[model samples]
Target: MSDDQLFALANALPLVGWLALCLAPLARPALVASARVVAAAMAVGYAVMVGLALARAGGPAPDLTTLSGLARAFSDPHVMLVGWVHYLALDLWTGAWEAEDAGRRGVPHWLLLPCLALTFLAGPIGLLLFLGVRTLPGRRVPARP
Candidate 1:
């Protein structure tokens, strides 16, 4: 496939995968079951896409398919995905922690779902949105006795 095709494919798979997860509750008997399926599918798809990108980037040989393939993949894709993934992962982790910390905050789960979706679509944007929404301004009120 051409670079354009690969780039399109790279972006489409994660977006579609997240959309699948977002809609899975309506399609399955159990939310946990749906989540597991979506997560597995996305992980595999992401791995393959990254590998292909690295190969196309001219860092490594495509034949390297295992952990041993790293030296090869590292040569081309330039590890660009790693930094994004790291940022996304940390953002999600902290978001969850902040949600837990909001004892009386009672933030809705729906509010978080979109942020999680965006993180996978574009890491930095998703993370910033998450933080911003979490810290949204509150209504002003007079002090109580």
Candidate 2:
């Protein structure tokens, strides 16, 4: 795919995922499942694109006008930010999934909410926040054998 097409697709992912999630309440279980699968696939594709950008490293990048030229785009802030947003969206979606999973597992919902918000705003910050929240001030207990 061309650069423009790739960028457009990358940009569309979060919107598409959000739309599906938003519509899920009225959809059948199978429909919701299909939405989730599409969201997950989009997230994975976003990640692979990120890896490709890192590999390119700010050199003469792809033209995006041609399928073969898509990987040729240089590593620039614009591209990086687009990739970052994709990462954030994926990260948030994963957090949402985890929150649902945690509910199924009987973990508290409160624990997941803040992390989700943090990641939604900025991907790395959510992880940092989670780690910060997880670290207790109390003394560490000895490991049980």
Candidate 3:
């Protein structure tokens, strides 16, 4: 497939997982299952894509050590796709964790949807938001071992 097509696939994969996760409060099992499956896919996909990016005819790999270096890295299409997928994988993972934690705490579905959205938009930011919510005074239920 073309690089652009592959990039679309990479983007779509996480959205599928994220959508399942958004329904976690109603179906914790689904979220848990998708979390595991998506995590596996992300890992394998990243490894494969990294290999491709390294082999592709393009500029050097992203220099994450500095802001300018990082920008230069994303100038390549393959590298950009890898970076996007990286975000998608981590964001989904974060959202899955939030769903599990929220489930344990008995947080309402109403609240979790937005948190999931935020997580999808910005991985750590959403996690921080949920952490704040998780810490607020409320009835906390013990999680199943």
Q: What would the TM-scores of all predictions be?
A: 0.37, 0.43, 0.86
Q: How well does candidate 2 match the true structure in TM-score terms?
A: 0.43
Tens digit per residue, CA lDDT, model 1, 36-145? 44445545555775676656564434455686565655454335454333343344343333333222243345665676666655656766776676665662233546
Report the candidate with higher lDDT, 2 versus 3: 3
Which number leads on TM-score? 3
Candidate 2's displacement at residue 58, Å, is: 8.8
Range of the 10 consecutive residues with the lowest summed lDDT in candidate 1: 95-104
* lDDT per residue (tens digit) for residues 24-143 in model 2: 434434434554666677667767777876686665545879755554442555575556656745664654454444333433346655765676566678767755554535423344
lDDT of 3 at 90: 74
Model 3 regions more than 4 Å off: 56-62, 143-145
- lDDT values, one for every candidate: 0.49, 0.56, 0.79
Q: How many backbone clashes does candidate 2 have?
A: 8
Candidate 2 has its poorest 10 consecutive residues by lDDT at 100-109
User: Clashing residue pairs in candidate 1, if any?
Assistant: 59-75, 59-76, 60-72
| Regions of candidate 1 where Cα sits further than 4 Å from its true position | 24-42, 45-109, 121-145
lDDT for model 3, please. Answer: 0.79
- lDDT, candidate 3, 17-128, per-residue tens: 8878876766797776787589669868888888876787476545789989888878877778888777877778878888887888878777887788888887777888
Go through the candidates in order and give the clash count of each: 3, 8, 0
Root-mean-square deviation of candidate 1: 9.7
Better of 1 and 2 by TM-score: 2
